[model samples]
Target: MMFEENPPSSYLTRAAHSEDSQETITAISHVLRDQEDTQLVPADDSESFAAPGDLPANPTSPQQRLAKLKLLMTQQKAEYESKIARLEQRNRELQWEIRDTQWQLGQQRQRHRLAEMKIRNAERAKEDAERRNEMLQKEMEEFFETFGEINGWK
Candidate 1:
């Protein structure tokens, strides 16, 4: 038998006889009788009507079984192919994400290196400014010593 996602509507279990109202049954029967191809099989009459020898031979002979099996295999193959396609798409998405993450990480590393260089340059400039200030202070002191006597109490 072929695998099915859902039972056919006709094969589904109906409400119990106690749950079915007479009006519902009458309405259903009327609708069914109106249909040209609808045959409401009597629940117990068919067994009594046909003798053992009168019944048809096994409908699912080897050839029919083989055909059904082939159909089932085809359906299974289609389902597998669909699943594989979806999984392949997912894998491609994951690979893209990985590459994006790597690119972002590389950008961050570049930014970090640039920041460190900026910090080093600023520190070197600060040290140079400090040395210039010290030299200027010594010059000012020497000028004061040499010119204080000329300008005032010599």
Candidate 2:
């Protein structure tokens, strides 16, 4: 389901401020740090190197710094792409779970309907048996009375 169609406000707020989101941000920062540390930049290429806590004052060579920026952007792009892929896979899993729950609900409803039908049938059978028993009891009483009358015992 698309979240934008009928998104819950609480869900959006929770997602934005979630621990997982914060961890992902922290991980991306670490990745950027690691990449920067691993790259070997020559000391003579001072145009691309920015001093710690100091902004690059030289605007003479923009191309070198532009190349470094492009590289960093590419790495971050890859990290974000992988994260998106994982989130998509999780979405699919959740959809399947919802479908399974719905199927179980349908099956339970069918069983409940069947149970109700059986109960009604049982009630009808009980009523029929009680009626027959009353008819048989009346006939027995009449037979005993007739026999008693013919034998002159009454």
lDDT of 2 by residue, 16-125 (tens): 23335544344445434432553322234332343333434453224334444544555576678789999999999999999999999999999999999999999999
Task: Name the best candidate (by TM-score).
Answer: 2
TM-score, cand. 2 vs. native: 0.57
| Residue-by-residue lDDT tens digits, candidate 1, 1-154 | 1222322222112432323433334433443332213222222212122223333455332322333444355456656777998999999999999999999999999999999999999999999999999999999889897788678964
After TM-score superposition, the amount by which residue 151's alpha carbon in candidate 1 deviates from its true location, in angstroms, is 3.0
RMSD of 2: 15.4
Model 1 reaches what TM-score against the true structure? 0.53
Error of 2 at 124 (Å): 0.6
Clashing pairs in 2: none
| Alpha-carbon local distance difference test for all models | 0.53, 0.56
